[model samples]
Target: MTVPKGKLIIIGGAVDMGSNISAQENILQPNYIKFFEQGILKRIITESAHHEASKVEVITTASQIPELVSTEYISAFNHLGVNHINILDIRTREDASNPEYLQRIRKADVVMFSGGDQLRLSAIFGGTEFLQILKQRYQKDNFVIAGTSAGAAAAATHMIYRGSSNEALIKGHVQITAGLGFIDSVFVDTHFVQRGRIGRLLYAVASNPGILGIGLGEDAGLLITEGSMMEAIGSGLIILVDGRNMVETNIYDVEIGAPVSIENLKVHVMSIYDKYDLLQHKLLIKKVVKVENGVFIKADK
Candidate 1:
């Protein structure tokens, strides 16, 4: 398989785009706005080929309130000194085929999908000319594709369309579907730690151990380069569920709605700056060094 030259950034939910908080609160607490602005969004701009000069296209097709999402993204990008930004308000399959929209996608250096219903993304853009062009650019050019929340969930080949967090461990609770296919053999779940979504992601991987499961915590993200090297980013944690070495699992024997049993499922927890090799299934930890009174202290191995 040919390696993709482009990059993919998948972020967890609840990225502060300055739209959630009131203007009064933002004025009073300036640091609150700076947190996300200086963090993930800044990283997105920096990863692009031209940085601030890159033309970014924000697709809000999955969102119910596309106008609001569009406004928030526009404001956020503008704050980061990105003037070349366009919001693609594609709601229907017909909209996905618009000549103008397709032309804009061709010119964009970076494409971002906002948080919403992942199903909408797959349903609307599937088998469309727009998706074809996007895939082609990602394969041939150094394009950047970024998504958060539902957008993140849909970036993989397999997606969890429906699954309640509380009863996720129950058999048949998690529903899997075909996604955008930007990444293969991986299932992504967002708002991981906050929502207690490990069970669902585990179920996903247990159903198919060949596929690696990634659980992204809120405000956390993975910067995937060449579709193999994944570098963790942001403030929260990243969970990797590897089921390749499973000793036993009764998932196939268990009936629907029954509690399944599994043994020896391997899991890895990662933090900011940590790296994971997707193709090799290896983990590379970053060493932490502390300074104390002009003395440098290395963390114990």
Candidate 2:
């Protein structure tokens, strides 16, 4: 019996009202994918991956991670075979940084974080018990971990919260920082191209050229596993920025709001039906949209 370990699905648009029904089934077997796609079932699936889950637990570090941002979440659980549901509402500043609450994060087969303020999530659970629990679950049980927007932002070792391409690189330095270490050595940014976050991820890469920068468009996500591999799932695309190839950077010397010069940075854009080797830092699958991680975004309004 080769039990299924788990997979992480990070997506861009189609976050609301079944916009992402196609990819939600990534957590289930292909034979059972259809059941998980139904609107009602997905909601159950989302809620099940929590406290009630004898084998899973859902963690919400952000206040905005409600049904409004993800209507199908709770229902996703409805269709899923997994059984568990626990909502972690550590929204306040005090609660986010609380170590005790973070400790309870361990009892889960799937530790998921809802999207909101990447900074707030990081500040609350970055170095606390919440993070440790996730690491253990993922490494030991191959728990299915997932996040979007701010939630996705907090998955990487180096995380970007807020930054403006209009502003100078140094001006936005403190605006971003390290997020939860779900995926180490990668700087993650949400609302990516649509929000003009390339500069921010570039800045993170410039700070240290060893890390890879991953930008997830709204309604898009990347399913990453331990074998140094990741699958692209969702409507949008996933951008992989390899800072290791960076050669020149005048980020610090460049004036705020002025153009900065950088080169030798490698970039790969991936779309649906694609895969990336996180450990190899290369694209193992075809680039659906020419691997640009296209910059298109559908408004929430």
Candidate 3:
């Protein structure tokens, strides 16, 4: 009964979406005065920044008020020509549970959730009207939804806000909040290998067995679609922990920060140029390779 939230574009954790870095310039599309088809988040932001037609929405309620409402962070939307930007600080507002936010959720062409508290973001829209509107907009292809860090982590059906990776992947209670659930059977963890979060994601995957775990490094993400396509993008690697056929010991007794003895937990990492077929549940030949660090093997021998 529950489907994916929408098409998703996740940027690896800790990206300075507010910085004036020149590299981010490439992500901006300054010109879109007319006809369009592509829906890259950056492209949409750039187009909206210069005009008022496109809507930019942000939901960051985890950190302190000042942090959640960082003007620098808000600039990410302003730069994209977003005439109207709403910060769904639902943590502070009980009204976020009301249907008013749904109206904004439906109108937004680019909905972005800022980085802060993944747990907060989840609690805000976990099972509310806002989530339904997000789903509706996704089905229409009239929007591009993206996130960074905490936001990125919650982009999948299953999400991990915080945890440690000391050893055995003990299944811990992950905060399953409201995210746009754009990636089905997929749980996401930001700052993957770099943060040693593979364990938490692995643990979450083990609990669901039917799902896949995605761990993204800083500035890296998996651009996914309900149509079953996944594109790895950004500066880091996207680690895939597949447990469809995993065999393991009793994960129930594992303690917080305790490790579980897991077996047959397969791992795969991909790059920005790579494409994966989710429906087929395998990497497309476009470029499959055994990888190390974050660099993958070249397709050509």
Candidate 4:
């Protein structure tokens, strides 16, 4: 059977919530209030299964602190009034194969992966039935798979296992490994601008020109529909590193620690409301809207 495409909500880390921040610190800040009141979790809840009968299954396998991460997600989702929420703490390969956990994946309308070590996610659930069914559901059913940070990175086929910002551009500096393979056309990175991951993402695209690089900034996310068009949401930026037109490179000749040389790398900075066409490798500009005399109107063509 041909697997149908589903939506993906890929969030960068440090998404705003009251869990980590002290109440006293955010009491006087409007942005903090907004962050707590209407952040990515709200969006996730809205896009998940039917409001009256939604079933959200959160997988906290990536995190070392699974209990804390699961609790935070439950608290956030609960605020949105999702009907049912469950956390699958599949810590070991044996845990991944648990029949109950497998049933949870089969019945969930939305499956969310929490942030932690990407390698742990890959190592534990790489070839298990749980992952297979999850992929199948995403392919054949109207399922939603949302992930943040490490979870976001592992959603792609090719994942960046490890790399340093300082030496990212140098050949052999970044390590690549097989990920869950939910989306295969692009390599994803999170905590992007906040953590200075541009270099590593650039290198990933440079080495494999066939794939595009997505760098999601902290507090930002990309809501992808039909597996192609991406709508940027949240408070930060989304960086698209397109190397299709790259003209020059010295990667093969360079030493391990030598700087990489390349030219004509195209990049697009997308913010909230901006859309990106992944298949065409282009940014889709929306109709410009303007405020005229306190009235909102679309700009004339």
The candidate scoring highest on lDDT is: 1
Q: Please, what are the lDDT tens digits per residue for candidate 4 over residues 180-294?
A: 9888778999889877999999999989888999999876888887777788777678899999999988877888888998888898987766788877776865444864443
- What TM-score number comes out for model 3? 0.74
lDDT of 3 by residue, 136-244 (tens): 7776654667777777777777677655567425445443444557666777777676657766777787777788777887667667666467877555678888888
Candidate 1 vs 2: which has more lDDT:
1
Positional deviation of residue 151's Cα in model 4 after best superposition, in angstroms: 0.4
Candidate 4: the clashing residue pairs are: none
The per-residue C-alpha lDDT of model 4 at residue 88 equals 92
RMSD of every candidate to native, in Å, equals: 4.3, 8.6, 7.3, 4.3
What is residue 268's positional error in candidate 2, in angstroms? Answer: 1.2
Residue 289 of candidate 3: its Cα lDDT?
69
Name the candidate that leads on TM-score: 1
Worst 10 residues of 2 by lDDT: 27-36
Segments of candidate 4 deviating more than 4 angstroms: 1-3, 21-33, 286-301
TM-score of each: 0.91, 0.72, 0.74, 0.89
**CA lDDT, candidate 4, residue 288:** 42
TM-score of decoy 2: 0.72
Better of 1 and 4 by TM-score: 1
User: Candidate 2, which segments miss by more than 4 Å at Cα?
Assistant: 1-8, 13-56, 65-72, 79-83, 92-105, 168-174, 255-258, 287-301
- What does candidate 2's lDDT look like per residue over 1-301, in tens digits? 2222555555442243332442221212111222124222233244333423445445555645343333345545533544455566676656755666555555455556665567777777666555676666666664667776667777767766667665525544436567776666677777676667677776777767898888887556676655356766555567888878687888777666556678888888876557777666657655223322332222221
